[model samples]
Target chain A: MEEVERLQHYFQVLSDVNRLRIIKFIDKEKRSVSEIVKNSSMSQPLVSHHLKVLKNSHLVETQREGPFVFYQLTNPKILDILGLFEEMLPKENLVSDFSPMFCCPSWWGNSN
Target chain B: MEEVERLQHYFQVLSDVNRLRIIKFIDKEKRSVSEIVKNSSMSQPLVSHHLKVLKNSHLVETQREGPFVFYQLTNPKILDILGLFEEMLPKENLVSDFSPMFCCPSWWGNSN
Candidate 1:
């Protein structure tokens, strides 16, 4: 049943577009909640909810500097997982300008 | 919205314990409904329903041989996806004997 729990946790994490976007942001660079809100369309409360779930599932880890909490992905391989999933999507389903991104690899190189 | 539908689909497919099992069985080899039911703990109706969803999402494909139809994974790359996820499972979460079954490589190698 651990497999069920582990998988259910992961699937639940991946199922939410906000959570996936949060991971993409953290994967790009360690970020505080404010930095995350600045780059992402999600508001403070939605980011908080997704971050809590990602942290509980161990997919993400956090660092604290006095009053600030910075979050980063716990595993780099998760990038590979997300990349593979992106490959599965047809090119047409993605927006032409790639605004309102579902996911992309350039976040790491394009920023920070 | 298309990305939402697509991710919702694949996450929904991978999330269910029974649906993952069906993919495992078919991924091992193309199987008839009876072969699936025989290898899986799910009942006839349940298997039928999961198959419908998987088929709808194109994660699975089926072929007919006279009165019997056989199902198989639509893409082998899905194997790499599942395998990567398996790598993330902690060593202890798995039952030592591996009795209940899960997404495993040997389902293809050990059988048929």
Candidate 2:
């Protein structure tokens, strides 16, 4: 897919918190749909719908184990997506300064 | 903004190709709304609407140069967002193989 299309798809999948949590969980380890429901505190059908969206975007993939289906982050490129946000957005860090580097030209110059 | 919120807003702005083109142009250098309209093959009102969306998302900012409003990429972090998609997405490169590195475990290990 084109970069814009992929970006749109990534953002569309991320528009929902439920879907974001699903990807985060899957990133930790592959899990079945029911497990996602337990962790996300959302309905099974809702989880299934969100998974379908993720799958369609190619952000995730599924594997069937007997009667259960397991979902995993098939695309490692999502790390770049998450890392992009991590690098751009501000975060709260207890032990250190959590300010974003992009705010300063010096940081940008050094990093680049 | 929070990463999820930022992601949603970025995606929402990017969902329209008109807005995407606006950002891409601004990324190259600051340009007036009229210049954007000329380059993008879009109408003035349409470009205005799209610029409003981009401004709201904090992806692009504007400066009033006399009678003209010049837009520029204020947030360098958008580079990370764009980089995320570029890394994840498939691109065509005529000179060499443009295959994504994410497809292989070795690439991930090496890059990470």
Candidate 3:
């Protein structure tokens, strides 16, 4: 693929709130699907779907250990990018509303 | 807007290839709309549209001097994020295709 198309794909992969949540949740340590499901409101299947997208984009990678598989960011620089965004975040967003907008769509049966 | 929503919008703003091209084109120095049009294959209206989106996202800002409006990145850190993406770009993408991808989808009447 061309570089621009690849970048368009990369940014598109990151365009979702849930995907960003998943990326942040697994940023520090690798997490199994069950662990992610247990800690977050996302269902097991939803977590699996986002994980697949992340993997395909080469943003996240998986490791197998026995029967469980753990997922982690492919590069630590991903966090640096996120950190830059955080730094660039306007003060209005930080203070205007502390509550979350929403979790997964109602159809997904998200627990939160 | 919520932080995640704001970020989602920001990423969406960056997801398009033309927007990315425009961002890169204006990265080093601020440029007037006509200058951008003259330098890129994109037309004047399309350049204006992308600049509006970029400005709304706070990724780019504009200045007016007499008859010209100059657009430039709001923060240099935006380039840092792009640099990170470049670093993370796979070797396959860099080496696989040397030809230009279709510019402006052929419908935009791009000169190139």
lDDT of each: 0.69, 0.65, 0.74
Per-residue accuracy of model 2 over A1-112 as CA lDDT, tens digit each: 4566655545555666567667777875789999998998889998887887676556677888898998888776676666667567433321111122334565566421
**lDDT by residue for model 3 (B84-108), tens:** 6766754343222223454577578
Candidate achieving the largest lDDT: 3
lDDT at position B81, candidate 2? 66
DockQ of predictions, in order shown: 0.13, 0.15, 0.20
Reference-based lDDT, residue A44, model 3: 90
Q: Provide the RMSD of all predictions against the true structure, rounded to 1 decimal.
A: 14.5, 12.2, 12.6
Per-structure clash totals for the candidates: 0, 0, 0
Q: What is the TM-score ranking, best to worst?
A: 1, 2, 3
**Fnat of the models, one by one?**
0.21, 0.28, 0.38
Name the candidate that leads on TM-score.
1
User: Per-residue lDDT tens digits of candidate 3, residues A1-112?
Assistant: 5676777777777888888888888887989989888878888998888887777666777888888989998876787777677667443432222233556786898431
CAPRI level of candidate 2: incorrect
Off by over 4 Å in 3: A65-67, A89-112, B89-112
Write down the TM-score of every candidate: 0.73, 0.71, 0.71
TM-score quality measure for candidate 2: 0.71
